[model samples]
Target: MFHTILSQLVGTAIALFARVVTAVRGVWQGVEPVPRQRVYFANHTSNGDFVLIWTVLPPALRARTRPVAAADYWLTGKLKTFIGREVFNSVLIDRNPQTRREDPIVQMVTALDDGASLILFPEGTRNMTDQTLLPFKPGLYHLAQKRPDVEIVPTWIDNLTSVMPKGKIIPVPLLCSVTFGAPLEVIEGEDKAKFLARAEAALAALAQEVAR
Candidate 1:
């Protein structure tokens, strides 16, 4: 009980700090912030990307949303492990296939089964290049195929790369916007390649909108 309370306090403090640093705003262009189960797939640019999204969500939704993050990174240190597991209640997946004990897709589906919305980065890693987005990994496709009922929303996070650049401990104060695009789904009989391509395009389109 004390641990749960401490986790909630820490989570609130983190959200407040993120807002102070980034002045982040949520722009729902294609969907409402209703109480619907959703998979929020965004472009990966910084470690703080999911935090910005979580900060912008309504408190009720934020309570139920979990970020699907890397187990190796979050579990390495004691403080990070506590924050990732207790504060955010993240679904941590081992990115290494050879040493992983469980399938990443099954882990995600289990979270969905437990009625938690997800903040996912389909790129599977931070895009550190000039490209607006890296090609998406197949995990998003498999997740959609497994849970066809859940809404998958394309999210575009702007100005975060500048705010929290690679290897920077202190984030520069910057105005950031998280644009939530329309929800998409797998079409009937859609192949993995085609479905992933369409999902990528949908997310890329939101980036274009943010550019304007």
Candidate 2:
């Protein structure tokens, strides 16, 4: 009961805050926001990227979308733990595990198998530069291989890097747009490096669209 109430409150807060402070605009290309099993991948610029993405989603869809996050960061404090588990329904993973047996991919695949959409940061960490994006990590490729049927969509969050630049706690009020590009295609038996490169290019193209 408490978790349900917290989730509702968090939803309301994000809806209002996103509209009032950020004036966030959402653009969909080649696909519309609907209740579909998908993996929404994006470039990680700020710690709040998932929040912003979750905020922009349509309410019903928002309820079903879960953000993939790091357990160490979100599980550190009581308030954060509640928000991460209850509010956002995040699939928190141990990025730096002590043993090789601890795999984040297993967690992500489990979420997909349970019929939940995911919000992922392919970059793995926050970017410090002004470039469109840093190189994407291999987790995305592995995840794709695991869940081949799920749609992989490339999303870009513009101006977020400046809104809450890395290492800064306070967010600057700014206008940012979240553009959801078309689903990325998975070729038959594609190599890891080649697939990752294509995925990076797809996101970069969306960023370019935002710039225009």
Poorest 10 consecutive residues by lDDT, candidate 1:
184-193
Q: For residues 60-127, write the lDDT of model 2, one tens digit per residue.
A: 88888999998888999998998889888899988886833558898889989988999999888888
Best by lDDT: 1
What TM-score would you give candidate 2 relative to the actual structure?
0.95
Q: What local lDDT does model 1 show for residue 98?
A: 100
Scored by CA lDDT, what does every candidate get?
A: 0.94, 0.87
Give the runs in model 2 whose Cα sits over 4 Å from its true position: 99-101
Show where candidate 1 strays beyond 4 Å.
Answer: none
- Error at 14, model 2, angstroms: 2.8
How does candidate 2 score on lDDT?
A: 0.87
Pairs clashing within candidate 1: none
Model 1 residue 14 lDDT? 97
